[model samples]
Target: MAQPALGPAEAEGPCSTPLESPVHPVDEKPAPSRLVPAALQHIAAMYAGVVTPPLIIGQAVGLDQAGLTRLIAASLLIAGCATLLQTLGIGGFAGNRLPFVNAASSAGIAPMLAIAETSAPGHQLPVIYGAVLVAGAFCLAIGPFFGRLLRFFPPLVTGVVITLIGVTLMPVPVSWAQGGDKEAADFGAMKYLALAAFTLTVILIVQRFGRGFVRQVALLIGLLAGTLAAVPFGLADFSAIRSAPESLDDQDDGEGEGGQGE
Candidate 1:
């Protein structure tokens, strides 16, 4: 005898199951219009950090203006290349293929400064380079094992490290708020403090009220706003950029004469 007609739900088969949807959607690539501004924001955020190391080291090594310019250019080039590699990655061996800014590390500053102080003036940079090469080799050797060690760093340890980093860097912003140079006539002036406070308030307001991309680029907005605020207080200076080329030209001429004498 034929069975009664089955309903649509049962007609497929007893084994049939509904297809499950993904809990989270994959991220889509952003359009060029959206990407350019985002990229600029990232660059603005990291620009100071990438340049500061070269600036400090160049001065510490007594590099002439031309030499310092070359050092700055090289630092920027290396940082851009490293950032590209980190973001795009090569084969499986290099880079994590994450959104990371690879720049001259501030961690090495103290060691590099120590090397500069203890070594002969002519040998200081070479010694620092040699140390860097050794450290790179050590890191390469330990790369595989390093991932395993990360499991030991639980949330507590991670939090402590992050807190310590913030604590260590706190003095930097304080110095900026005090007009950078402790010996300057305007150091710790009320005007500088007010400008800093205005910048901080702007940042907080943006973070609290701004939406989407505006919120994401809040730091950059804060920086631009702070500079504008400082301009009215006579704190924003453009003399350095105006004189840089002339200084470099003079240094190059001095070096040429010194080379002829040698």
Candidate 2:
């Protein structure tokens, strides 16, 4: 059945009325493409950082280049695995969906060094591992109970904890600025200081002036620039990375019977 056509004014009324159209809210979403690439670049930047500490420590403990290389490889592999677990999350593990790499924290250095002096030959690595294992267990033991204790932490206590964290972290920046090692031949050299300054400048510049992709990749860019600047000064070494083996047995835990680097 056909109806009479509407007048121009009546037809226009429906089109002009704001309520005539069903409105849906639009959300501005960030581009996934940008985030994915930026994330990969971030992973690339942290790869070296995750591997280098074990290599340096192994060498300090008198491990051969091969053994140190193995330690480096293990460190990288473990960190990658931990990161995967943290990001993807198993049944009850993992912290968040964001990437999170784990390593032997520097906070344990003083304790480890103290243990090293008294530990028997080839006992260091095992001792370190054992300590780490125990620490994890201790955390597990205390976590739920400690979480409940959060109610007791008032704002003042929380603020004090935060202040303490800042106080502790101040030394870390100073150490990096002066070069990571105190015994290095060029420790506190201008070259090292310049590298640190350049790194800081890169981060500041990227944060201040960069947009989108550049901003997302700020950390990677800063690290890369800093490393590259250090390369000509012989600060970067691929020697350990290249020689690193896939086998765990190649590294000697601090135990003499356990093997080298111990």
Candidate 3:
């Protein structure tokens, strides 16, 4: 009653293991030259998205220039802190130690605007803040359960959600192409349309033909190229940079004069 012979794989026992996938060099710590551009590319990709929420809310709340500046600064600081915490997890506490950029979510804009509209003048922001705090706490409380529930979302559902998001955001680039201001005299100028078309073409070309980091940063490259092209068409304005310091100085002088008079 001899036993049957074992298969080749079983004969090798536990020592026989599948070969692990090789890691590409680009996945590792890149050179300084590559790293800087790659980092700048990520910044370019998310910069507008990161600032949009605060910009819209600040305008809606009637914040002054200085106040808007502070809001933007604070938003950037908090996002940076959150990104650090996420990448460098605390001891048995917050963060998943992943590479993620945390910023003000555009998803909350509608609800925030509603809250602002419902609140009294000069009190809208406070109400919005209170609501945000409660929402944050609620999210924290349900974090574990929420993660568990994600298992119910199959790839089909996830793909549909992603497609829906892309569809929803399709108008953003269209708005940008229309000069970003509906009231502008040349809102839908042919030049702007051409610029957008050129940018999209560049992005497509890069994605199709470029290799390595170039392909990875195609969107950023397209953005930069479009900006450069815009300058020649009088679409890129640098007047704000020149006026910002003067505005700050004027604000400071006004404040000082008021204090002296008092």
Candidate 4:
């Protein structure tokens, strides 16, 4: 068979030997950068976050200054320990070193709030802890079964659950927009609305165009942005521990003891 010769124009165009398909680069995983800055960032991010829920719940329960102060401290300490356990996993007991930072899960928030509201006529921390212990046991007993049944969840069921979760969480954004507490005198105030709007805008912008690391951290960025924006309006309180009288502390202790006796 006779081979056809290429046209002069085609022959001159970049040596035309099929161009070796341009040798596209393989998507190799990038080497991890130094851990010092990342670890510091993780710790700082987690430390500030793990204390807020207890503080809010304490306030909701009408705890006097001292009682709420202790609650906040305890929450921070426990959260720190939980985070350490997660990041530096225990052999068969606790940890799972997966960039995991443990904090209070939002799933428990509503139930805990209910307990805080209905807690027997006095200090509710003990009751809350007791209930948490029970709930944790319940989860531990069921979690493995759920894990084993992972294959049972097909795409349809996963989609339904995800849709339901989104629907359920819509109220959280609404509540935050309305200042986070239903009973607050300024609940639903303009300041809170503005903060929520700013956060939503930032997230939307990120989702629309952000790439790589910026896209990955968009939620964290939005949260921080919302928090910073709220600070000037008295929404993000980072005041150092304020002193409370010993009498108030003793009073709570007495109430707690009395409630336990009853």
Clashing pairs in 4: 89-95
How many residue pairs clash in all the candidates, one count each? 0, 9, 0, 1
lDDT of 2 at 114: 55
Evaluate model 4: give its lDDT.
Answer: 0.71
By TM-score, how accurate is candidate 2? 0.55
Residue 138's lDDT within candidate 2 is 92
lDDT of 1 by residue, 2-48 (tens): 99999876787654554433233233467899778878877866776
The true-versus-predicted C-alpha distance at residue 33 of model 2, in Å, is 5.2
**Model 1, stretches more than 4 Å misplaced?**
1-38, 52-72, 97-130, 246-251, 254-262
* Per-model TM against the reference: 0.67, 0.55, 0.67, 0.58
Which candidate model has the greater TM-score, 3 or 4? 3
Candidate 3 structure quality by residue, lDDT tens digits, 1-262? 9999998877887557644334455346778997788777666556656777787777678787677887888778887788789878897778987666676677677677778778899998889989999999999899878977987999999898767655655665687788767889989989889999999999999989998767866877788899999898788998756666556678788879989999
lDDT of each: 0.79, 0.69, 0.78, 0.71
- Model 3 off-target regions past 4 Å? 1-49, 52-68, 99-106, 109-128, 246-262
Worst 10 residues of 4 by lDDT: 20-29
